[model samples]
Target: MTQKVDTAVVLAAGKGKRLDVFETPKPLLKIGGKSLIVHTLDNLKKAGIKNVFIVIRKGDFVQKRELIDYPLNIEFIEQTSGRRGMLDSMLSLEGKIDKPFYVTVSDLILSHNPYKMFVDCGVAGSADTGALVCFDSRQNKESGANTKVLARDGVIREISSRLPSYNALDLGIYYFSPKAHKSICALAKKDKTISSVPQFFVVYSQKEKIRSVEYSGDAWFDVNIPKTFIRAELYLGEENSAESGESKKERTSLKNLPKTVLLHNKKETVTDITVKRNILERLDEYEVIPSESYNSPHHIIVDESIDSFLGKPILDKLLSLGYKVYKHTVKAGENAKSINSYVKLSEEILNKGIDKKSTIISIGGGSVKDMGGFLASTLYRGIGFISIPTTILSQADAAIALKQGVNGGDGKNLIGSWYAPLKIIVDPATILKLDERWVSDGLAECIKQGFAYDKKLYNLLKGYKGDMKDLDFLESVLKLAIEDKVRTIEEDLHEDKIALVNQYGHEFGHAVEHLSGYAYGHGESVAIGMRVSAELSYILGICDRGVVDAHIELLEKYNLPHQVPKVISPEDILNSLKYNKKYYSGEPRFVLVDKIGSVWRDKTYYTVNCRDEFIKQAVEASYN
Candidate 1:
């Protein structure tokens, strides 16, 4: 029978010397959007463990804020002594843990199944005094450096930080009773020199019967250093895939799936945009293979910042399926969307032998998509391109657009052409890991689209207010935002028609991005830009008072900035607008909204030529 555990002790006091450059405590490091200890605490809570005891060292105050939302009644014990080892950290909570307790390292990440399995295995055998979770040492190439264990039958015979044996690796998770605690205390007192828990476990195994619970699957990761941390993140992607029941062949087949929004040029359909959560897990489900050649290598161009989140999984899955994969990691963010950056990336693609027939998987936010799409369009004149956008800004805006371009210092999207991807895959799960600020930034576009095109979307933004972390709401917002963008793009196809309504606030948004030297992110800039546009329309007596008020009310509701930053003067904004791409010949033109869900169109043009003095008044009013 499996014994129940009510308490858990988490060892988080390890001095992470290797990751000293980060200056962050190892346990406080974020993985899959949550800190490592939070993951551990969450697993403990899910496994029915009620009380949590976390051990830490001095100056470790950051974790207190991280644990504020955790439901468990947690008690933190500080182990101040440097001489103290893993046993000493647990000894700090000796009297508090009276029941059979779970002990785990905070740096360890495991899925819910393994925690339950480990606990069940820990308590079942009559001869077992305690249980230690172990995995095959060969699972990680650097696992040889970790703690090793030797077990015969179900009992762990030897355990060491550096053992030459071929046994499974110690996973640093244990379930021990009060009796075993007494033995550990006695052994720890006798050997005051021992610091690590694994070393102490080695001595304890010599005297007691400690059972081993072997772990299988990609659900566990020991992230102590940078290398392991990266490996663990990639494994997390794999774990997400493992959880999805769809087989590769079944998932890759597009026959019965819901068709995404289709883009059209004149009478011909250009491409489709597909949005789903965890799409990367079953990437093979889509027909990414080039019709011209099945034998050509596939080149994947990913943003360096998203290497762990998307790059690793894409590489692993493609390699496993026997595809020759060539990768080129562009620098992260807007800076990568440059003429110089494009030249470097394009040359790298050619050097890697990626021909026109090769499918290039572009993985990143908007900036990556812009450069990657441009590169694919230029490579051998044109090549197959598939985009996997991982940021909120990218999902809401970039994924829907056909144009890909690098930034010119004088203006945003100054150098580029229209080149649609063969497929656009948006995974909501991947973007959930993005910082909340960027999510809000993406919502600014949603607000902009709602203001110009769809009142339901506008109403959706106004009512049902919640945090940006709300994925369900975000998913709904993205679908509507994409649909609205799709309709506008299909109508205009080339920014020449009513589709120019899509650039509603982008004129000033790009200017703000330039004038502030990008102090305000694209979303924040657009939010402020939309407000300025509303104010400008109101000043011109073209838009309703209600529309202007709605812009203020909705921008505030979303926590988006409506006021221009103090550093940028009205004159600076006016000067910057002259360089904007929306200018007709010499005069600056702005897309004004007549009301929510309607754009102010002047015959053939959706934008009106605005006077400099009027823009100055609007810019000054924006500060208010």
Candidate 2:
């Protein structure tokens, strides 16, 4: 049972010293075509928060009131402390919030489900004392704004305003239950003047409970600087474009895909499964097929069981069309994702007298596609390959992205490439045989895509209630995921600029998977990576804590790991990052969120050149 929260307190009273808005409150600065304070208010309303408390400076009350005219009940309080801090504004709200309440900074633009996050924390008692939203610190350019938390078994032990090193940076957003409110008030009385929320939490944690809730799938922006404001605008434009049903054109110059036919035998299957078969058949008829003289020879790759069901008929059709077909299959599991398997497959292709013009068809999950795609890309200096994804995870997420090599002796996908396939043929009808765990794995990637690219996709997942194993729902998810990936790839065909956003989770993921020795699946490692990246983003001041919490929520909802595995120490993980391909000139560059649907790329906003100690602290904070 989750506790319900109805009230929201937005702390907006800070002097705009950093923003150079000495004439006006910082919250009044424009972001994404709206005032920053109004953006916060609108987000709170969107999260279903009814009552709002806006703490403002004494003189700016008139201007603040003029900025927003809403029907929902709103209270305006003035901070009497001259040139005081966040703690002072929060102290002013003392005793006023009688019910469970959420507190956040006014200068942040967040696309998060705050109501759900608060209610979930309330019900789980995840924050017995109080819950602070923690964001990844690596993505931010600004430091020292994050509050570091240390916890064990869901119970927070210590929260430090001046953490020597930490992972989770406290985003100003908080959920305070009645008990927490009492504790905060008591602390305020004892301290007399409140200066920082992190400091308040540190004092409050000594006496009562203080917990942290990680948020996933939300985009948060702190518009304190000019570049961040620009980023916020760009993000808003992207969001608007997505909402308006704008479709980006796909990239060309790759070899054309071959003609494909869907031959399904009479078997017990759902109507949606049949519909999917019809869709594939229709696509074959409508889309243009490549000329064999110019294109590579098409090979028929299928799972052994699927081959038994539909392979013979398809192979016969291709033969009738004067095309030579080669069949390939591999035993399933992580073992299939090996260079050895790829070598054997390559040898088999050569044995068949296949040349550079021969195409390799990959019909399986991510592992099979990854191995086969790598083989085709590297052999004979690159050949054409098509994906026929059978599993939900592959069809929806993994198949759409570029394929890399399999995990080698050191870790998972330790060796790989950025080779895009000629085409990806998604036959969602095959999702019927997927296990629940596989479906969950697929959702993990889907959730990640939603976090990095589309808020509507995130909302769809948030509202989803059917079992993940349901073929129909999984199929729909696959379509959305594919579209998302295609949009990203089209914008960044060579992954030069925009495509870096797609690597959101891979940075931390690679390190974790390497240290785990490939015990965890790609999706699992990515889930943890997403959380760590979000925390790092907050620490670097690229995004707000609320956005970090939103990212955590998506991961948690899908049963993904929010913390790094205990076996891998922070130092080891930090060491592995140095070798990441994204590292530039001795600095580990990060693709961090500027807002939802928008990412800060290398040489765009700010550079990340922190020392090893800072990196260690960030990794440790993510684990806690």
The numbered model that scores best in TM-score is: 1
Write candidate 1's Cα lDDT for 422-504 as tens digits: 88888888877787778778889889989988899999888975676788988999999888788888887787667787788
TM value for model 2: 0.53
Name the runs in model 2 displaced over 4 angstroms.
Answer: 1-322, 402-404, 411-420, 601-609
Q: What lDDT score belongs to each candidate, Candidate 1 first?
A: 0.77, 0.67
TM-score of 1: 0.56
Per the 3 Å backbone cut-off, how many clashing residue pairs does candidate 1 have?
5
Top candidate by lDDT = 1
